[model samples]
Target: MLASTTTTTQISSPPQQKFSLWSPPNPSTFYCSSQLLSKPNKHSQKLQYTERILDQATNILSVLYPTSTKTFSNKPLASLKTFIRDFLKKSKTTFSTLQLALLYLVNLKKSFQNLSFLQENIQLLSDPIFKCGRRMFLASLVIASKVVLEPAPKNIAWSKLSGLPITEINNAERLLLSALNYRVVLPFEEFVEWNILLHSPTVELFQKINLVLKKEIWEGKSNEEDGPHYFVHYQGWKEKWDEWVPESRGLKMTEENLKKQKDLVAAHTTKKPEKKSEATAPSSERGKKRKSEHVDTVDEFAKRVEIKIPIPEELKIKLVDDWETVTKNQRLVSLPRDPTVTQILQKYREHIINNPTSFNEKEGLKSSVFQEEIVEQVTDGLKLYFDKALGNILLYRFERFQYVQLKEKLNNENNGSNNGTEKLGEATHAEKCMSDYYGAEHLLRLFVQLPSLIAHTNMETDAVNVLKDHFALFLQWMVENADELFLKEYEHASAQYLVDAKNCTS
Candidate 1:
C-alpha cells in the first residue's frame, strides 16, 4: 500500500442567507434530499441530533458486521459510542470535527472494495488482513480527525488516547487508506453543506422515520418471538417519538399496515384449536404428552441456536483445573509459550500435508481433505480468532499482566535498532506476531467460545456442521497430544511484576 496523503481545501466564508424549508442556496452543487426538507411535525421539538446520528451509525454497523458486533464484546455499539464521546472529551475537539469524522466513516464503507471485502469475510467471522467493523471505523475516525484538526495528534498520541496498540493503529491506518484508495479529502463547502443538511430543521426526525434493517427481538420479546420490525421514525419529528412496530406496520405510519396488523391479530385471536380424540387417552395423560412434546421441540430449537461445541470430559476437567489454579491459587501461565499457537498450527498443517490419508481417516472423511490452500485459510482464521479473543475474554486476571508485557515486548522488538523499516509497508516479523507468544491453552478457550461466535455468523447449517466436525477432530488431536501441547502447571507471578501490574492498574 502507498503512503496516505491529505489534500486540504480552503474556502472563503459566505454571507448568511435567510433559511427556508425548500429553497436553500448552496455554494457547491450538492443539494439536500427531499426527505430531509420535508415539513416538520409537532414532535420535532424534542429531537436530539447527536444521539440520533450516533444511533443510525450504530445501526449501520450492526447490519453490516453482526458477527463482529457479537464477537468483540458485549453491547459493542454502546462501547463504540462511549469511545467516540471519550475521545472528543479528552481531545477537546469541536463537534464539527465529530461530524466530519462520521462523514469519513460513512464514505469509507461506501468504497466498493472496503464494503465488499468486509461483507464477504465478515460472514466467515474472520478477516486475515483487517480488524473489521468497529475497530476499522474507529481508525477512520482517527484519520479523519488528523485531516480536519490542526496540528493533529500523531498515531502514538491517538493510540494513547484511544487505548489501542500503536502497531494496531498504525496497521489500521495503512489498511484503511489502501481500501479507501487515499481519497479522503473533503472540500470546506461540501463539509459545511453536509453538516447543515444533517442538522436541518426539515430533516426527518430519527424517531419518526426510522430504518428497519433486520429482524430483531424487541424488548419484552423472547428469542423465539423475534421477527421483522419496522422502526417508525416520524418525518421531521424528534427521536423520542420513534417506535418499533411489527412488519405489518410500514416504515412510517400507514393506515394499510395498521389494518393489516389488526387483521392478523384478530385472525390469531379467533383461530380455533384442533380437537383431539377423547377415546384413546384421558385428558390428563393427553395434556402430559402434549407438554412433553412442546418441551422437546423447544429444547431442540435451543440446542440448534446455542450450538454447543463438543468438549471432551478430560479437556473439561483440565480447564476446570486450570481455572482453579488461576482463580484460587493466583497462578499465572508462563509467557511466550513453548510450541506457541503458530508453531502448533504450522505443525498440524504439516502433518495433514504429509499424511493426508491418515488425517482424513481420523476425521472420517473419504474425500481428500489435503487442499493446502484451504488448510492455510482455516489455520490462519483460527490464529486470528485466538489473537483477537485472547485480549477480550480468554485471559484470566493473573494472565493479563503477561499479555500486556508480551505486547510491550513485541512493540519494542519491532521498533528496535535493526528493524526501522516496518513502518514503510514491510511485513511484520514472524516472531513478533501475537500468536507467537500464546499457546494451545489460550487457543483452546477460543474454541470453547467458538460456537457463540459462529452462532452470530451468517454461515449455513451445513457449513456450521462441517466446522463443528473439524473442531472436534482437532480438539481430539490436541487431547491425544495433551502432554506436549497443553500447559501442565502455572507458576505464581513474580513480586516485581505484581507491583508493576498494581501500578499500571492504579
Candidate 2:
C-alpha cells in the first residue's frame, strides 16, 4: 500500500530539554563539513586501500603455509588446532571476524550512502549519527562481551575504544534503534543462502558481470549510453573474469562442456536397436517400412516438445477476482454507485422546509430539481452563501436525518426486547439485511445505466462507503468475465463499422 499523505502534529518537547534529540541534523550537513571533506573521493579511495590490504594477505597465504601435516607428526587433532592458530597469527585476523567486519562495513556504507542521497533530495533529517555510531559500538561489544568480560582485561574494550561517555553511548544506542526503526537482525547470510537455493546460473553469472561493469564505471572506462551500473565495486581482487567473456565465446564454451558430458554418458550407456521387426512383411513392404521408420526416428529427434498443463476454469476466475478486488480498492475504476445521493438530496430538501433559521433562499438553489431561472434569482437575492454551501447543507441534513432514524429504530427495538443480548442480535441482523439490500439496489442501478445517460454525482461519505462495497462486487464480476465481454464487443464493433463504411461509400 502507498503511504498516506496525512500530516500529523507532534507535541514539541519542553524548552528545558538539552536538544530535540529525536530530530537529528542531516548527515550530509556534518559529512560535508568534516575532515573527510578533504578527500572528495573517500569512498572509492577507501575501497582501493582495502583492496591493497587483501592483496597483501593473499600473497602471504600463497607462501609456505603451516598446515596440520607440518604442525604435528601424524597427530590429526593437535595438528588441526595448531594449523588454525598458526593461520590466524599469520593472517593477523580470524577469518570469521574479518569476514563479518568487511560485510558489515560494506552493507553499512551502502545504506548510509543511500540515506545521504535521500536526505539531500528530500531535505529530511536521518536518525542522529551519534545514535548509529553508538549502536555499532554496542553491537560489536555485545558480540565481544560474550568472550571478554574482565574489568580491565585484554584488547581494547568497546566503551573505552569508542571514546564516548557511557551516557552518550546509551543515548546513541537508543538513537540507533530509532534510526533502524528497531530492526536489529541483518540478512546478509540469508540472502546468500536464498541465492544459492535459486539455482539459476544466469543470476550468479549476471552478478559477476555486474561487478566487472561497475569496476569499469569506477575506472571511467564505461560507455555513457550503456546505462547506470547496479552493482557496487568490492575492495578486493576480481573473481569470475573468465566467465564474463563475450557472448559468442561463452556460448561456445558452454556447448563444448555439454558435448563432453554427452560423450562421457554415451560411453557408459548401450545404443538403441537400429532396425524394426519384419516378422510378417513381404520383400517390397520391408523396404517401405525401413524408409518410414527412418523418417519417424528423424522426426522424433527433431521435435522439441514441452508439456503444459491448462489452468482450471475455477482457479482462473478466482485469480481474476483477486486482481480486480485489489485494483478496485486502489480506486482505478469509474465513479462507484452511490444510493446516498438521492437520500442526501431528499434530507436536504426536508431540512430546508423544517429549519427556516438555517435555510435561506440561496440554500434552496442547491436543490437539483429547481428551475435554473428560480435558482439564479434565489442566489442573487441571498447574501451569506459559499461555494461549498450545497455540499455542507446536504451533509448536515443527511446526518441529522440518519440520527433521527437510528434513534427511532433503537426506541422501537428497546420496547420489544426483554434483554440487551436479544436486542443486540436483532440489531445486527437488521444491519446485515440493510447492507445487503443497499448493495443489491446499487448494483441493479449501475447495470441499467445507458452510456448516454451516465452522469457524475458528488457522493456523501456514507454513500461513498456503500457504493465502494457494490463497486467491489462489480469489479469481481468484471475480472472473471471481462476478457470474453471485451472480445465480443470488439468483434461486434468492427463488423458494424465495416458495414457502415461500405454503406457510406456506396
* Count of backbone clashes, every candidate in sequence: 8, 0
- Tens digits of per-residue lDDT, candidate 1, 1-506, equal 32323322222232332111111111111112111112233122112333444455544443333324443323334454445445555665434455666566555444433456566545332433233566766566666666655566667676667666667677667666656556666643345344434442222322222232122324436355555444444434554566666655433222344467668879867946656767636866888996664444323222322345788888877877776777668677776789899899988878766777876766676343356665565676676556545554566655666777777776677768346555211226433666887887777776665654444232346545555655776788788889999887787877897776544420
What are the RMSD figures for all models against the true structure?
23.6, 28.8
Top TM-score: which candidate number? 1
Off by over 4 Å in 2: 1-156, 161-177, 186-506
Global lDDT for candidate 2?
0.29
- Residue 384 CA error for candidate 1 (Å)? 1.2
Q: Relative to the true structure, how large is the alpha-carbon lDDT of every model? A: 0.53, 0.29
lDDT of 2 by residue, 1-506 (tens): 11122211121222431211111110110111012113235334323323332332222121111121221222332322223333333323322233333233233333444646456533222434322322343333333222222221212233344334445444433443343433333332232222221222332323443443344223333565544322222222242221223322332113245577568779867666555657535755888996664344333222222112233354345434433332233211111213232332233334334543333353342333233332222222111111111111211111223323444565466545544454221334333212211222222222222110111111134333323332332344344544432221101124543344223310
Best candidate (score: lDDT): 1
Clashes of 2: 0
Q: Tell me each candidate's TM-score.
A: 0.43, 0.20
